[model samples]
Target: MNTQPATRPAFQDRHILVTGAASGIGAAVARQLLAQGARVSAVDLDETGLQRLHAQAPHRAASSRLEDASGHLWTARLDVRDSAQVEQVVAKAQAALGPLDGLASVAGILEMGEVVDLDDAQWQHCFDVNATGVFHVCRAVARRLRERRAGAIVTVSSNAAATPRAGMAAYAASKAAVTQFSRCLGLELAPYGIRVNIVSPGSTDTAMQQAMWAQGSSRAAVIQGDPSRWRLGIPLDKIATPEEIAAAVLFLLSDQASHITLHDLRVDGGATLDQG
Candidate 1:
């Protein structure tokens, strides 16, 4: 492994696992890593989406379940909500791609509801995937990285975690929980030289965000203040692209962020304001 910075591409020969990778930000992260010469294990609950990603990524693995000739891409269907499954897949990925250099915990579900109307199933499921699911992936990856004593982790979060939102109690609370959880994990792993950070994105152009628009909301509604709900507009006057968020995640995972940990990088186009 030629780790000499100038001799190889950034992430060359590195094994990185990205969850929720079948679409949106996770997919972007996986694709970029493959282009950078990394062996990427992309996992998600969307099997069909995984198939599409396996076929569309830069290295485009010849085998859906295995690495390509360059050993640069692998895809799997993962239900991060299942702890046992999360553990199994993490181990399987490491076995197939060698020790993992880091993790991109992007698996999450979006929930939208007013507190009065929210039900147990919605709230529970929201927390289950958004918060506990992140815990399962991070803990599993952290255990392995702890042994190696070197790695980086970037957990995808959202601006809702820091800022308040109308009709988003469950979603906001769940994200906030994971944000603090990552910070705690970062503190505990610091002694082992493992860096853990969070990427909190605002409104991004993705299927999930598009879903909101599909329900009679317009992109302009997202960019302009929805004062009725108290949702602020994006100061940048544009929605972020998945690639933009992935760029932030990669920066935190790369050596460029070697000295940064327990940090939360916001990619929300200033929707939450700098105070968030």
Candidate 2:
């Protein structure tokens, strides 16, 4: 693990709400923020994953944790698709951790069926989880931050949003919706001192990717392309690690990016650029 030493505790005493913090990209972002001295309120649908994260303190110094926690981490089980549940969780998280200084919307779902082959329910579920879930979480968080007049938001999208994939129409459309949503939100939030942005990752070696690939034919065949140009369809020779994607999220949320917003930062190892 190549951990970067903190340049400064830019998020010290600040609170961040991380959706899908149970695992993968979300979990990695939470760990990075916690390590940088931020007090985080991690939320996810997986209660067991949250508990495990809480049990394992990501920080070295006990004092780095939010006091009164008894060495435990702040967490909540949230289903982002439920609007009411999202609102309730956001309210509780804010009260527990103080004002939310930032958010990383990483919770999303993926599907791999062609347009005609995908059922309406399947398409809706993809959009509901990946697109609507973002709206709910971002709106809930933004409402509070707007009152405070300061915050930053980074959303995880995908390279497929802009580049076509054979059997990923639903997933790609949902991600594309996410990209546009974030851009619009960025414009709207700027006046309130809030910034919104998107981070679109290329093929990543996460459990979700493996599972989706398993349900299909050969994974290599689905993702492979030319070798001479070193420009495979997935770009990277090996799938990117979750932590690598988290780094891009961290950069967007940091003060170093105060002037940046509405940008689709493609952390795709040049995959997006290769689309023709």
Candidate 3:
């Protein structure tokens, strides 16, 4: 006789942390989380971007009048590559915003070049942000979540992690490392009632993707397979908006995915030819 609504906002009152919250997918994720009534701690190295994001949240105007006053949103400047800083910022966020209910690790950098052409700095920078940075955030947050025995973590990787792409050696390799690391972390955290998952996106319509386009026609070229580079065209015939990827990230972090962990959900529009 209890026929309640089958669905409702899944993130109400939850405190979630999102990295790379300045622009692209990270910004989109923060915005969506705020709209869903979640308390969001938006973290990024770009303090300006973080400020803009905080100002743009839907409840910003009403927050000043609310008595609880802690506001559902906060911003922090964090460089995930530094383990000490990661730990410090995460701890600070918990202190200010309360215990974290979820984490979305979207901070990453893309360095393009053939392996032979890549220098030590370029290679290390790629792993530093894309792989090692993820490790720092995950490790810091996982310890606390493990003790609490609850929470979810989602890492945004790339389709290139699975499909080989010319001129993307370092980026691909680093993503691959995070992909496996997330799976292993998931396995370890499963017993503690925590979930860890990966979202692999392809050719999303963000500034980072636009920068890769050298010519006006580059967008079309991306839609049409480039045999010379061994890249396949998107079967969906369109680049995903940042919000599309954010939706998947939110789902994995919600109770709806309670039974899901160690899963890599591809948001790549079949760009990898369904490669597992």
**Candidate closest to the true structure, highest TM-score:** 1
Model 2 is weakest, by summed lDDT over 10 consecutive residues, at 63-72
Candidate 1 positional error at 149, Å: 0.3
Q: What's the CA RMSD for each of the models?
A: 3.0, 4.8, 3.0
Where is model 3 more than 4 Å wrong at Cα? 1-8, 61-70, 215-217
- Model 1: residues with Cα > 4 Å off, grouped in runs: 1-7, 65-70
- Candidate 3 CA-lDDT value: 0.89
Residue-level lDDT tens digits of model 3 in 151-226: 9999999988898889999999999999999999999999999999999999998888888885343778988879
Query: What lDDT is obtained when candidate 2 is compared to the true structure?
Result: 0.82
Per-candidate TM-scores read: 0.95, 0.88, 0.93
TM-score head-to-head 1 vs 2, winner: 1
TM-score of 2: 0.88
Q: Who is ahead in lDDT, 1 or 2? A: 1
Ranking by lDDT: 1, 3, 2
The true-versus-predicted C-alpha distance at residue 186 of model 2, in Å, is 0.7
Clashing residue pairs found in predicted model 3: none
